[model samples]
Target: MTAAILADALTQKVHQTEIDKELQALKEQAMVSGTEDSILVNKRQGAADLLGSLRLPHKRDEEWQFTDLSELKAIDFVAAGKVSLDVAAAENFYLPEAHQSRLVFINGFFTPELSNTNDLPSAITCQSWTNLAAHQREQLANYLGQKTDGNEVFSNLNTAGMTDSGVVWIPANIELKSPIHLLFLTVVDPTPIMVQPRLLVVVENNAQVTIAESYGAITTNCTDRPQQQPYFNNIVSEIYLGENAQVTHIRNQRDSGDSFHIATTAIAQGKQSRYQLIDVNLGAKLSRHNLQMAQRGEGTQTEFLALTTLAGRQVSDTHSTIALNHPHGVTNQLHKCIVDEYAQAVFSGKVLVPQAAQLTNAQQLNRNLVLSSKARINTKPELQITADNVKCSHGATISQLEADEVFYLRSRGLNDYDARHLLIDAFAGEILDQIPLASLQGRLRQCISCRTI
Candidate 1:
């Protein structure tokens, strides 16, 4: 063999050894907080076995070329222990719209004391995985950890270490009047910790529901540090929409600025189903979100609206894939990013229309605004169409605030900072207006105002 080839092989072997060691340590940690549910036990073991042979993704990988995991690898994190909090103390995190229909998880474990689900309708079933009934367990087995891109390593790691999950099931033909909230909170610790949180939502045929999911960090009395401690949050969510179902999903990620957050959301839509997603990313020193959606039946409709705001030295990456496997599918996506200071933002959106998916209409656009010379933005919007009759278009743009527009705003009797802030707000208002909840929209508007100032 050539000397270069020998060196490459040695590098691969070393990486594989490191991967194995990491997997073993995670598995041992999982066993300490293992679940008694038989189905979950089997699922965990299966994922652990699969992880044994897979290596961590690196810059050499195509999908992760722009994301660097070196900082994450440097921290040796242990599993977070079960912690308790008073319900009254967590009032600040509660939303008035979902006061009675919320589920709260702390450090990846369901916290019954801080959750309120007593006012939910009979058509909905919401509970933790450990509290699932026999029939529910049987149904969950069919979908849990099943719908994925099939190559997400962090997702598999979540399954391997998951001891509990938030499950939401809506029956057929039922329309929920209020939105359900899923709140996952991470607590900072003196020692770096790792937490895996999982969620499963299943909507039956002709059902309609709205979901608001969020992730944030909290501090306890004993540990009053200001979110400076490092932690890792690995999350996985699976959503299944039956035929003619309608689901509106809103996701918000506002973790600690010193933490690492990685998430995967896999969605499947049945015939004539409608799925709409409004995603907002605002925090975390380093974060990545992988969103995958597949149309399982004809006449499905999908919509995605995302906004990412980053500052300081933060890095945020979003990768989305929409597959139209059936005919008569329709999809529209718009992603926007605002980067300031030395922050960096990355976005890659892929739309696939195969030959079998005739008469598909798809549109994708990515827009970015840079506020500093050191700020960076990377965006790629792609459409792979094999269907001759499909109407598909994709485009991306990365630019700074328009000088002419800013000057025009300044002429309207506004200061330079106010002019720039107004322009930035207008850029973000397009996506924020589409959100279904007025309260959330107002909150997000305030957040944007503070960030710009």
Candidate 2:
């Protein structure tokens, strides 16, 4: 079919009236909450208007070409009037019970009463995203949406709807001995509630800190509010790395079985700085993540790693972009997906090297394993290099276990299932090794092991 034909076909597609109404309400909320930050307000309001006019995925949207969200139009779920969380229910998702500091959120609202920070390092300061100083607002305003190109609709959607998300500051020259955990708990409701939790993290010059941003829905909903149901989660996180600063980040999203999630992350690395990301998406009806980075200074380095285990009819999509704009910057990205039953997974990795970014070193690889014929995987890895003095490469692979490898294991007295499980684990072991927390690492390993076995 020609382009004109495709356009005509999409124009004839139907959209759910409910999606239009929900979008209109979000726009009105944004207009009512006018901002002193003129740029932000304009972006938010304009984005809201754009989203309101969207077609809500007809057959022509190539980006959402693989999955259809027409069912999202039929749901009558409404967002709660006031979002809150029970303090007791908020304590269960912490890291191994061994983490020293934690900040909790229930249904996107910050729960200060339930947070514990006594275990924080003496030289460090940790506060709620709402409690940041006026001077800090500049950081959040400047870095929040500034991190990425907002390539997808969900990215712009997150930018327009979220206002209460927090800011994290690690002051200059401070090295922390403990990890800081930010926990988000979404309440289940009968009506669909769209929640976008935003984060702006700053690691000052020479500062060292590790952060764990964990997301999970309150699996058990109240019997009294059965009419209210669990909703969808859309989040965007942006990070800034100062010169010589080093940071480690872990983003784990394991929400309720029925909920949907979409996430995006953007990071900028400074000279001599190091940044790493570990993305583990284990839950959600349909989950997707977009990650990107810009090497704006010489000697900066970044590592991107993601591991996903999905079953049922669930699907996960990940797309990453890396740009090296200065000399001697380095980037390494690796991702793995394990699909079971009727699940599907997608991966896209792209690297850009500008002419000015000389002597850049970049590599990207995506690997996937499918456990059943009903499962499918799509992998695309590419590189765009303009610099003559650069070392850049990209690759991808998708397959099941090799019969010869399985035969060797069975001959050595191992069951076929055990042998297959071992190989899958080994494929993801590199990412699992980079996790610094011993307890979380072990838990993740066990989670993957059980599902694979």
Candidate 3:
């Protein structure tokens, strides 16, 4: 019995030793891609240590109760540090001249070689955030991570590895005549590429700008086989809208189906500012998006929308939070999810109004259309309002394809499968149509239409 106990104790120690080595490897990567920000490093190290303590999720953590990450833990994925891409490979993302300010990142590092700026409008200056003028960087550091408290483990990791990320600044009162188009390329797939997209948009008072961001993969890697089972795409986005600044933002993700994607986007909008955010997710095996926004100024307006279509064994989870700390602030959010096959989906939204925030207007609507009964969707909408004068509402609905809608389409001479697909497309149209850029709108619509039962 003493010998057996010693053997077991030794096994446990060896296992822990391997885990610590793995975490240290991740930390070394952060040190290699150095960021001058000391605060970011301290926070990142703390987060890494904390996450190392918790076991990988297994459908138990309340926030991640629905999606299962078992497949990711089973494989050994390589860390993808830096990559390169040519200009021609980015043809799929062709934004018109009217909205064609470009910022390109190849393998999470800003690549000037893959970017185009000749056709950019004179009013909008297109350049890498890392190369920003000295004054701009100082001003940006003030509000860089202010909106996000590093609430999640993933955000802290990205914060520590911030050297590769970029920023976009629309100086105060500079109305961008066109929408800025930012692109990130993830090549070197088979080796389990890890891509981190970092972004910050500062729209100062009376500044008006529109941004369209998209991601794509360039290389297919079979060099490492199954060990590279789970590729990582970790993205962090921060947007700051000053008083009376009107900004519209859109993000599109079309990545490898085997990829594991986790993203956090936090926005801060000032008084009387109007900001709208739209997220389009059509890829990834296990994907989650954290959308958190805060309204600090009065009379601010925000519109948030998301549209996702899942199939096969894919899973997508979206957690959104809208906090109103000031009086007379307004926010509206809507999420539409479509799941098929044996896939699962989840949507959680929380709206808060503090006692000091009187006359706040907030509402959340979550709708899901499950094509197969086996395909599941879970939605939790929570509201916490401490202000007696606040007006807040939240509602969630989950249903399958309506027979009548399919029948009406079938009456138009379409097959049952075609009819079902058409109705689902229509349901997602409302959210995709919210994209102001015509190219972006059409591309998102096409992605939605290509979904299969």
Candidate 4:
């Protein structure tokens, strides 16, 4: 063999060894946590078997070219142990809008004391996997870890180590007036650890509901600290919308800057169903989110709005794919990113319209604002269309804050800082304003101000 070929083989061997070691450590952690359900045990074993063959994503891969995982690979992380928090302290993470309709998980373990699902309507069932009845567990075995194709390694890793999940079920023809919140909080640990949190939501035919999913850290001041230790949070969420059902999903991620977060959200829409998503990402040392939507029936409609804000040396990446498999499908997506300092942001959005998807209308756009010369943004908006009668378009834009607009704002009696912030707010507001909750919008606006200023 040539010298280069020999080196490549050696590198592959080393990578495989590392992956095996990590998987074994995670499996040990899962054993410590323990699983009571047979379904969970079978799923975990299957995932573990698959994870052994898959290696960590490398820069050589097309999907992970711009995002680096070396920092994550360097740490030896064990599974997180059960951490408890005072009810009063956990209340700090609750939202006023979902005060009575929230489900809380700490370090991937369901904490019933910190959760409130008592005020929900009778048609809605919100509980954790550990609390599910036998019939319910049997029914859920068909949906959990079944939405995605199971090609991504991080997602499979989550399934392999997952101990519990937050489940939401809405019966047919039911409409909820309030939103349900799923709060997953990670506490700073002295030793590096990993947590896998899972969620599943099923809305039956003609049912309507709104979901608020959030991931954050439990800090003394509710902010990143200098002594914060590094940890890993791997999460997966699956949502199924039945025929004619309507569901609105809001997801927010604000982990500690010293932590690593990887998440996947898989959504399936049935005939004439309407699904909308508003995703906001703000904090993490390194973060990646995979958002996938599949149309299971004809005449389905989907709307996606995403906003990402980064400062310091944080790295954030978002990959979204919308598959139109049936006829008369409609999809619209808008993603915006604001990067400052030495931070980097990456976005790759793909819209697939096959021959069966006639009369499909899809629009995708990605806009980015770079504050410093060193800050970087990598964006790719792609549309793969085979149907001739489809209307599809995808585009991306990357530019600094327009000097002309900033100057005009300054000329209107605004100082330099105020002028710059105004322009940034306007740019981000286009997506943030569409969020359903007023309190969340206000909080996000403040977070943007703090990061940009």
Candidate 5:
């Protein structure tokens, strides 16, 4: 390789030494602060140990072949402690639909005053992990901090840094009339910091609930130059659904343009359970989502839908995996991305149907639209089926806007910008229309209409 190439490689190399030093500093700070309970302290220590032995994932990893963490490596991250919330500052981020059941967290710390759960039914319990009783903590020990062992450097790092989490439990045979919303707000911090927000949900047999999770930043005082604070949000969510349970999960990531976000959602479903997830990504300098789901029981149905819109120098990557472990399982997944300016989008969807997953039906599709000559998209769909009786298919497509359609709209007395916006709205409506909450749907549509740099 040439000298320039060698220099680039050096810069791209994983900064494991610096990352370890930061981790050690955080551990020392945790010990000195001594603000957390033994349960959480032990969990963080275990996760820190695991992360100490590993390095952040890079483009060399098979699952991360399209995404790079050079920007993340360049940052010197510190722990984000609790910050005083200006009630007026957080009002703009609340959702009216979930006004009665919303949970608010600032910089990954739960704020009870901003959260409303008083009108919720007695059967439904929503509380923060740090407030749980001793017995409750003991009950969740087996589930917390337990994930697929190695190669998950970010997940481990998140666990090590996790201080508190949100927990929701629904009893059997109950259905929530309205959706539960979680609002994670990142305020301006003088020092660059990282926050890990954890969520755990458990639904008993024959229960049903809807959850909407959103992320945003607090703006400064200047209206003319609304600047966003730089921060990193590493979030993890674990969901468990019992037999005949149903769940609708909608997550939106709209952070600051100067921020970084990495999130993972792990789900386990029981027999005859139904689950659907609608994921939307619109902000952040670099954002990635890892979705892993397993159908552990027979006759399960799962659906995953995602939409990514990027402009300027933004980058978005989504990697998802679905495993069918039992017979009579069905899955349908569709992911779409719209890129403009100098942005880039990446999608990787994989479905696995093992020998035991006979009579499985799976379909996966990835589609991308590039609105600018400088924009780029990389999409791939993988299907591995060993069951002879399974029906599985996967495909991908990348295309630019149709010139004839643009011309038709232009002839209808609409300007170029208007025509383009109309077409993009229609393109994104397919996924936006599926959002069950009208308030959330409208909010997302409005966000999609605005152009961000």
Candidate 6:
């Protein structure tokens, strides 16, 4: 009996390792991949240690109760550090509006030759962290990894192995005439790859700028076989707006269907600032986005709009939070999801108004349209307000394409597919029209219309 008990104890110890062996391998990779004596070494090491000490969240966790990570447990992924890409293959993915002001990263490492920064104004600074000098990196030490908390485990994992980073700093009182775009493209490799992309956008007081971050792959045919393994993309974006700054941010993700994407956007708004966000998701076998924003000062205006379009057996989850801590705060948010076939989607949004946040006007709405009977949607809109003088409202709606509307379109010389596509396009156009760039808006409309079920 004593011998059996000792054997069981040893087995349990191995089973209870904080992170899986796959993640442990990544931690080891972080230790040896980057420069050893750089200014960011300590920060990377600290995040690595934190990642090593904590376990990945499971379905039992309240925040992740609706999403499952069991499928991720089946694969072994190696860190994709300092990899190269074919420039010709990556040329088509760059957006035209940001042609002269863009940064491109291949396999999470910034590619200088493919990026264009020659036309940027003197007041604006746009460069990859990999190309910065030691002193320049030191100047950024105080701002890096400062806004996120311990609850962001995936972000910590990303920081542990992240070697490529992009930075956009706008000087005070300077407004950029064009937007800056960050494009990250992943290529397939024989071994399963894990890529981490980090970005920091800082707009100084009285400055204004438009920024966009996009993630995708060179090809969309990664297989599960050992020779053509899948990939995982973990991205984190930190946007800081100084007092009176007006910023417009856009996030676009269209990865391969065989990939896994986990992204987080943390925004900090200063006094009397205005921040707007447009989030679009189109492809991924499994994807989750955590959007957190804080109104730290009075008279701030915040707006968030998200649209997710999925088909086949895809699964997508979006969780957002708006924390108003000051008086006279205002916010508006709207999220929409379009699911077809056997796909599933989840939307959870929360608005927090503390006692000090009197006279806050906030509204949250979630709308979902399911085309197939097998599709599933789980939505929750919550408002936690402690202020007596606040005007807050939250609601959700789940519905399908009405047959009568389809029939009306069909009678007007449109086929079944065209009719269905028209309805879906109208549904998505509400958010797509919010985009200021005509090129991007047209591209989104074409993508939605072509992917019609």
Q: What is the lDDT of residue 314 in candidate 6?
A: 84
The models' CA-based lDDT, in order, is 0.84, 0.72, 0.72, 0.85, 0.81, 0.80
Q: Judged by lDDT against the true structure, how good is candidate 6?
A: 0.80
**Mind giving the per-residue lDDT tens digits that candidate 6 earns over 135-200?**
767877777777765657788766655555799989889988888888888887767677878998
Put down candidate 3 lDDT per residue, 228-253, tens digits, no spaces. 34577778888889999998888887
Better of 3 and 6 by TM-score: 6
Summarize candidate 5's per-residue lDDT along 1-453 as a digit string, tens digits. 112211222244433454445446555665676534677767766665566566667789887887888777766666676788877888777777788898899989999989998757976878888777777777777667664334587777667666678988888899988788988988857666677789888887999999998888876642112254567788888888889999999999888888888998998899999999999898788899999898869999999999999988888999898989999998999998989999899888889999999999999999888889999888879998889998888999888879899999999999988888888999899999999888878988888887622
Error of 1 at 373 (Å): 1.0
Backbone N/Cα/C clashes per model = 0, 11, 1, 0, 0, 0
Give the poorly placed runs of model 5, Cα more than 4 Å off: 1-38, 221-228
Q: Name the candidate, 4 or 5, with the larger lDDT value.
A: 4
- TM-score per candidate: 0.91, 0.84, 0.86, 0.92, 0.90, 0.90
Which prediction has the highest lDDT against the true structure? Answer: 4
Which candidate would rank higher by lDDT, 5 or 6? 5
What would the per-residue lDDT of candidate 4 be over residues 68-166, giving only the tens digit for each residue?
A: 988787676767777889887677668888889999999888989899987798657899987888789998899888876567877877786666799
CA shift at 144, candidate 6, in angstroms? 0.8
User: For residue 412, what is the lDDT in candidate 1?
Assistant: 88
Better of 4 and 6 by lDDT: 4
- Candidate 6 error regions (>4 Å): 1-38, 220-229
Q: Is 3 or 4 the stronger prediction by TM-score?
A: 4
Find the candidate with the highest TM-score and give its number: 4
